[model samples]
Target: MKIFRLTFFLVLISQLALAQTKRNIDHQSLTWIRYYNILPLTEKWALHSEIDNRNFIDPICQNVFVLRVQGRYRANKNIDLGGGFAYFNANTQNPNNNPDYSVPEYRLQQDVTLINDIAKITFHNRFQVEERFIQKANATELLDDYSYAWRFRYRLQATFTLWEKEKQSLKGSISDEVMFNLGKDNTKNTFDQNRIYGALRYAFNPNIHLELGYLKSFQRRASGIDFYDRDIVRFTVYHKINRKTKA
Candidate 1:
């Protein structure tokens, strides 16, 4: 009986060890180039247009391309409401990697931004929601269906004036954003990703500025056990038209 019990315990231990899963993590480096334009239509309304291209570092491959358009309404001095439509072209090494097909994603986004000013520093709090539709593929990696996912994102950004002139300024910015997924199928990895970013912004005039930034991103893959840690270099151009000086 002692020998039999010993055998049983060893078998159970081996079975238990095989049940545990290992985590997979990939590290990547990338770059993003972006353009953003803001056009004011009236005293309290504006339009936003943006485009971005993201690429990989070592072999120089495109990871993703983005186009976004948003409409904003200024509710008051401290509040704004915005809604937008975005299209994303996903490549081989996107945030969610699929080596099979270059998929297309359509997204709808809505957000509210709160602004506060203290001395020469400005703080922006943004809460955003997204409805995402990602094109799906079949067993052989052929386009077969579309999947729906919902996500919520929150971002806190601060901008500070380092030096100022009448028409131009030098500024610094820092922001952190966290994203979460929601749905019945996403139970294991509801926590999607987080990004930490910082930048130096130089304004040539009231209507034009350039920003150079860096970002670190941590993301959980669809399997829930795999992760991607990425470092990114970012360059952006900010443009404005039709200023609302009095309003």
Candidate 2:
């Protein structure tokens, strides 16, 4: 009788342990892919490529690559609207003794601009959203634990034209952006990031221009476990695809 009771207790404990392990394995694993195209109704669109890298305090590394297309449309003498999408991929090396990991993401954004000719001032506001999917390793059945995650961002910018010629102009702008995260998984804490950017643009012609800029970025994770701060510089070439009618 005593032996039977001990055996029954051990079996019950094993079952409870198995149940707890199953409940804790709630991490979602999915693969994500994205594509972006910038098309304008009137003008020729510009093509741009971007690369970003991050180095963590733990010496872990991650990198991202982006390709973008963008075009502008005039709403009136003082306003314009632009929209674009981006394909982004991020890869991170394992900190522990394991294989590397990668996450592929897709994002889209649109903007509206208000211009003042007399003051040579422009107010540009933009909204953007992004979604990410996770990838799983071989030998594991893909789980529907987590399917999708999203983020929203807003930006405000002010620009001033410094010089103008018959076919060329030099301009400078400053901008600030804020980001928020909205998703189904409650595990991710509030995702917030801020950026300050400054850029110089040179118009070679009415439809062609080039831009160079530097960005300062700061990021905070909701869980309060990880924080990233960094600076990046970018060089971009832009072209106006369509001709603008005189106002």
Candidate 3:
């Protein structure tokens, strides 16, 4: 417990220091909601789907929204493979000066989980990789938006139970994710952004869980010269379902 709290403070202090070195810092509050589910289709196959919505707090604007679906194959108890398609739309505060973007993205992803127990405390370490294709725009005689850029993402997360009673449990977690651009047009900013989140998770049962957390996102602007710093309030719900076999 002491170590976790100390690490949390260290992360916050680093973020603040980084904020001071950016070209421009925009402090925006975000309200984010997400729903995730996994439904078993067979012994080794499952369906995964998620919906995410984010709102800007200052002027009550819709900042971003996403809907995604994936077909997953459980390789083993510790690993999973998935391929999915996602629809993403993001609105900029100053559209006239910034790019208005919408992308139909496809991704191949992998998930790995590791668990360790020590001194009556259990820890979960989750690692994930994602390959992304984001659509691009054309300004020539043809107005096609099918041109795409590739990006790769990696995330690492750690969670530990803080308390438990009967069917309910409380947990704390911290995660960091980094994104890299893989194309020349998008390569000016080889490093896209970094996201850091600290959250409290509550498990209602074996199949249902909820998380409420604070997220700090540092993003490089499209011009590749400035940055945007966002403070977010995130809430997410998760559910899992198993397939029933006929006897």
Candidate 4:
């Protein structure tokens, strides 16, 4: 767990340094509820889908709803390749002081994932590239135009078994994900965000599981001078066709 400790420390340092450098910041609390599914059609091909809903709490305001679908190819025992499309209906708290209306975004993404196990501890490395088409918006609200952007993201996650019982087990996981925006449009906030998280997972069986997690999200705004520091509570459900042993 040295890697987790070191990475967590470095991330804390970065957050502190950012607080010192940026004066304009917004604090928000959020909740995310998600459902994820994976099904295998053949020995090598699989389908993955997700439904995610995000909301701002305290006053309980709408934030975003996300839908994703992907087709995966099992490249080898340790690797997988996937490509997918996603849709986002999102609202912002910028100009209106509250979320007035929702806007739309379409995204295409490609991903590569690697998995390894050491003494029952599992490590996951995921790399992704996304092409985003976001609906344009003014200070007041969304406009009719759309803009294009691209970004790359990487996540490192580790999971370990905590306890076991008959047909049930508990697992703990920690993960860190970083995103960087690319292209000429990024003048102010090229550094998108960083998410550091941990979760407790309970498996009823091999194909069904549940998780409750929390994360600190540090996101740079398009204004370049401002940032958003958010605390997010996440709950997720997993339904799989024996995701690990199916093949």
Residue-by-residue lDDT tens digits, candidate 1, 62-84: 89999999999999999999999
Candidate 2 overall lDDT versus native: 0.54
Candidate rank order under TM-score: 4, 1, 3, 2
The local lDDT score (0 to 100) that residue 33 gets in candidate 4 is: 99
Candidates 2 and 3 compared: the better one by lDDT is 3
What is candidate 1's local distance difference test score? 0.84
Clashing pairs in 3: none
lDDT of 3 at 11: 53
Q: Which stretches of candidate 1 lie over 4 Å from their true place?
A: 1-22, 94-100, 138-140, 243-247
Ranking by lDDT: 4, 1, 3, 2
| Cα lDDT, model 1, residue 61 | 81
Which scores better on lDDT, 3 or 4?
Answer: 4
Writing each residue's lDDT as its tens digit, candidate 3 over 1-247 gives 4544544565566556656664665667888999999888888788889999988887777777888888877676656567777776655543233344543555555555455566664554444556665555543222344445566555556778899999899999888766656665664566677788999989998789999999999886566666778899999999887458431
Indicate the residue-level lDDT of 6 in model 3.
Answer: 49
Worst 10 residues of 3 by lDDT: 138-147
Instruction: Give one clash count per candidate, in the order shown.
Output: 0, 6, 0, 0
Alpha-carbon local distance difference test for all models = 0.84, 0.54, 0.70, 0.86
Residues 1-247 of candidate 2: C-alpha lDDT, one tens digit per residue: 2433443454456445434542221111121122322224443233333333333224444345555554556767667666666555545422332234455555665666555444677766565555544433333343434345676666667889999989889999998776766765424434456677898988898666777777777555545344446555555555444634333
Give Cα distance to truth, residue 60, candidate 2, Å.
Answer: 13
